[model samples]
Target chain A: MKFGFLMREIGQGLSRNVSMIVSIILVTFLSLTFVGTAGLLQAQIGQMKTYWYDKAQVAIYLCTDTSPADACPQGEASSDVKATVEAALKDAALTPFVERYYFEDHQAAYDKFQEQFADNAVAKYVKKEQLNETYWVKVKDPNKSAVIVESFTGVAGVEEVRDQRSYLDQIFSILNAASIAAVGIAAIMLASAVLLISTTIRLSAFSRRREIGIMRLVGASNFYIQLPFILEGVVAATIGSVLASGAVVAIVVFFVQGYLAQRLPLTSFVGVDDALLLMPLIIGSGVVLAAIASGFAIRRYLKI
Target chain B: MISFSNVTKQHKGAPKPALDAVSLEIERGDFVFLVGASGSGKSTLLRLMLREEIASRGDLFVLGQNLVTIPSRKVPALRRKMGVVFQDFRLLPNKTVFQNVAFSLEVIGKSSAYIADAVPEVLRLVGLEEKADRLPNELSGGEQQRVALARAIVNKPDLLLADEPTGNLDPATSAGIVSLLEKINQNGTTIVMATHDVGIVDRLKRRVIELRGGVIVRDDKKSGYETALPITDQVPISSDTEPEQGNEPEQANEPEQGNEPESRISSTDQAEEQE
Candidate 1:
């Protein structure tokens, strides 16, 4: 193949169908953006899962002075009951499941509540005596919090044994659903991109049938006749892919790292590095899919 | 050289065969005229020779290869040794005369250094050397055909097939194109031209093979457009037993097979543009 000749042909073909080529680029851009978004969403979900789960704890809340008489006949968790509960946590049956443990007295719990709900009207009426003293146990594996729950539930002076993951699981499920939705939309868009690329190629082929006819007569091989048209599609799609990668980077920089990270400081969000990692895949797929589509569209005209 | 032995070409759904039980021989360097009316198998015979259409039955050979069994992959190699000219000049309207002739060589992966040299040489032969920068529309019908001829012969094909090359030219211009073909023929390239131009045909007095209703009725070494009989005569002559030319024996080679319908693809590369 003559490099100069092939380049000239490709340039002419692109110029002849400028509007169609632009549409191809825009469609590929939109579809690949969706794909990149889906990819990043999944990555973000993975990051949040590890961050939240690592800090998950099983909180054992003891009865306060306001506890009902049926559960706490002494009206509050006594010194003896606290000693018994602490001994039980140290027992061999519970020791194997515990990674580490800490205690929060009524004063500490009252201070945390006030810090969390500082702007709420109810926080002004809450007293340190009414708050429960708690044992916050970090387990060896977050999923094994059930072992601690079974050991402490209904024990004297225990008001409730709660797993933090139960609440976090709901948020994760919703996030998982959101990521799945992104992937579904991405699939539909990518399909449209494929179809649009093929149609653009068909129109391009029809417009250049004369040149193609001459090329065939001159004994140009099938690959030679088809190379320029295929390159035209690949070129347009690559531009779109690059634009999409730029969009994804902006989203990470402006929306994720800058915005979501600032608003939600506790959980880690997907960063610019993750978005950068997806660039090659996005661009590579765009190139490959365009080649396949245009290659298929030009087959009828290459009867030789 | 081309040989067709009892070749029968029948298109699907057509009521009759385009060429039926035809047997003929065209020796190397021979210029043969195929004269027939529209739909009288002249085009079909040219298409068969080009391997654009496969014979439904019998044997066909060109340039020492059995076309009946030539693989489709090898068809390009066979076509490289032959050139075709059509009634329409089929010159690229946007291309100047120089680029038009160079296009044929370029398509076949010729180096620019070679195209730069051969294009001008072929242009000189067709008498279009002075119009190298002029587009197709800027030239007269005869000059455009000269460019077409130059393009067809740039690679020095062993055989040239002209399908009504003079069909679109005036008589004076047609004579010029025919003479150029005669010159190319004299250079040892075989020429087979299909036409209905009786004047040029009668004037040239080359070997004429006339067809009627998909069968050959006449083959004469020195003949004119019409016989002493009626010009509309229709007859199917029996396959001739002419002694095969003993120039070269058929070589033993593997036989391959392919079938592709003839292409009537139209091109607008010659659309006229205002200067």
Candidate 2:
């Protein structure tokens, strides 16, 4: 209630426990930075998932002369076999799951193979007739590729049904593990921050026990005595929060944007806007936790 | 005003109650002296009056509010109407006299304008106006106790409780502090002072309530310490025999009286020791 007096007391308390306060700030900063990093990593993972899953397709390979004899018992897929596969893709039963499907004949496949191996010597020996034709089917939902795979597998002309998501799944699992590790580290750091903040508050209260005793005798309410100590923790943690937000923003700007985004142009990365969005959450949590820790810690000294 | 009806205070882990079946009434504008030896419950009585400790049995009332069942949240409001001083004169060592006195007002959320005026006025009353900027360590024992006194009364409380406030002062200096208390009491602040100083009690001849072994041995209207001493000269007895058995060791260890010179030297040393 007494703003000036509380401010003066907070200032004095912070100054008296300068070393403790600084450690609280540093710990809060480190912990909240990890929190932001974890959040940003999850966001980036989500972005990449959206980008890759949207482009993911189920490729059904048709039998060719060079295909394994077990898959192509007739030695090669005839025109009628290609026609049957195309009709199955357009069937009314599969319409809901299929977004679109394109036929890549042996000629188109050979052209892509040649371009892919333009610098290799084998590009000249591979003939168009030997390459298997593929039906590239993009599904509405990537996870729904199971329906399309079940439909074409072991079919008369199909050699293999391949979902591109299988490859992307490996990448995502690695990123997910990274995100989880960041969160685990953030959790540990935050716990340390809470303990450190409470210790700092306890030490401050101990050093000012005489003042607190006098205040209690003079009819100062519990809230009146605790506000300054709570504010001391809040102020230090807020500075840490701001610094963490700044670090998160810089990470997005420099590492995500300038480095990762530049080097890995195909994959989407978390941006500055995402980091800015996380600032409030990071700072809010820091302030709330610090206030609670200090508030609870100072209660032992305010028995009267 | 404070009233205790058959009040009993039993502290945890103690062999006997701190106060047993004590009843007394202190009206508004009365300066009452609670004189007792160590562990005789004088401080406990004062503490109960301030609501710092609750009576284990019987009803206790202060300023017309029942202290037994009063909600803890309302305790601060009750305390604001009273001031308390201790034997140690607990002044913040870093603060100057002005700041130390102003601190009481500040704690109760008084405006700076009121504090600026009231602090100097109270310091002037305690004869510390010139030493407003001096730290607690820089001041003498008498001056430090006066600052504590000034801080206690700065809020203009309805009652003042002093628990052995002059215990650490010399005879002459304790006289000065008592006179200051008398001046404050004259201004209509009910004062309840707990003390072991027989010299002050003998000199003042105030309303003395003496306790021995958790029970009142004497209550006199305008009586000196000699009139209150007949119970101690003979074998101490209690309405119940149990407490009398516990009083033997306490009575035997009672500090010898008429040792004002030694006490005066220790008072100065204690003041310096705090620094």
Candidate 3:
């Protein structure tokens, strides 16, 4: 019951089972690290969805004089054809789905092409009339891109209807799959951690049974007798969680912010601040798991 | 301080009960010797008094608490008022003699200053003050038993129950240990010693309770180890048989006696050999 004596016993127990304790710490670290990584990946996906979804577009390109697309049967789109397509986009049924739209003419497309590929031989060969005129449509619901693409893809004067959101969805699903895999691995590793914690506690209890019996004879309370073994588990698991938290912080600080942030500027990523929020949950998991495992171990093995 | 009324204890599936309908009273300061042969219920009676095993039938009480009805949570509190010594000496091998004694106090939440005061006092009582820093393995058998005694008595319990305290020592060392128990008892602790070493019991001439097959066959005041049975009864034959069998092995393994230069040199010789 004295703090000094209790601390000494706990320290002795930890040292005696150093190898087992180390395994518990490493397993807990591995499992919780996976949990933290999965959480951050999901956060990154959420950030990307918010930043990119509002800007998703369906770009319907008009035919040009030298168009390579099969749908562009006419040599060039006339002003009359442009008016007809614009009228169809503004029709009552399609109007509700279209938030807004803007047109890019042959001259504007040629200017963009010149700026993007100024040194290319293809740009030197192309004329302003050869460039396509495109309509960039903003939608009321980003998920409704299929409706717009399907309705206008083969329409006369249209070369192609490209939904930019489809590309982002593909990327998001891949990230989601990775997160699920991380969670699955975390579950298996956490099971190993829990088993190791309980086993370490049980072994300590058995090895000290003679001492425990003496204490029982001398009237030491049940709590006093069992405190050291339980503390063994709690201390090991907490150490693991502390290391795992540090690993998560390092990834967010150095890898995500320092490295990936610069390389992938097209999307928003989870920052250190978001990862820091998970520290409490990570440490709490360690503490609660140790407490429960040791509690069950003591109940079954220590019998007090 | 202890009483049993018609108590019976049965080991599950064993053909005979450990104790059967045994009623006896041990008052506050009674120094009683539990004398019996193997399987004669001496150890079982001691275990019952310690509440290690409950009475299967009838009422058993020690230190004013019913052994059966008392909640398991309160067992430690009840046990704290009594000290117990075993044949094996049960000292923590890693701890020094001083720490071993201090351990008993620490378990009951004694303050640091109290432990510091009480531990050395108990060590001194056991005449191991000079060897307090020595670990159990470092001490001789008698000295290790002394440390176990110091540990048991440190908390200053009201009852001291010793199950074969000198079972592993020479007669000379056993005599020394019995004197220590007698000293503690004179200080007002009730002593209940269960032992088959007949020499000390006969010399002490204390209350002797003899048992056979769970029944109390003899309970005598101021009696020796031999049951105070009538000469015509069959007990004398059994009592006569015990010394021949029990005392022979003890005499054969009697290590050099007393605090002589002979004993000291041999112990040091042993310490060197171990190293």
Best by DockQ: 2
Q: Write the per-residue lDDT of candidate 3 for residues A243-262, one digit (tens) a residue.
A: 99899999999999899989
Best candidate per TM-score, number? 2
TM-score of each: 0.84, 0.92, 0.80
> Which digits, one per residue and each the tens of the lDDT, describe model 1 over residues B214-249?
777688887976572343233314233111311111
Docking class of 1: acceptable
Write down the worst ten-residue block by lDDT for model 2 chain B.
Answer: B244-253
Who is ahead in lDDT, 2 or 3? 2
Poorly placed runs, candidate 3 (over 4 Å): A58-99, A103-164, B228-275
Q: Fraction of native contacts in model 2? A: 0.70
Considering summed lDDT, which 10 consecutive residues are worst modelled in model 1 chain A? Answer: A68-77
Higher-ranked by TM-score: 1 or 3: 1
- Order of candidate numbers by lDDT, starting with the best: 2, 3, 1
Clashes of 3: 0
Report the C-alpha lDDT of model 2 over A1-304, residue by residue, as the tens digit: 7788988999999999999999999989998999899899889878888988899999999998889988889877888988988888889999999999999998999999999999999999999998889999999888789999999999988899999999989988987898889888989988988889889998999989999888888989988988999999999999999999999999999999999889988767888899999999999999999998888888765677
Please tell me which model should have the higher TM-score, number 1 or number 2: 2
lDDT of each: 0.83, 0.86, 0.84
Q: Cα lDDT of model 3 overall? A: 0.84
DockQ of all models, two decimals each: 0.48, 0.71, 0.58
Docking class for candidate 3: medium
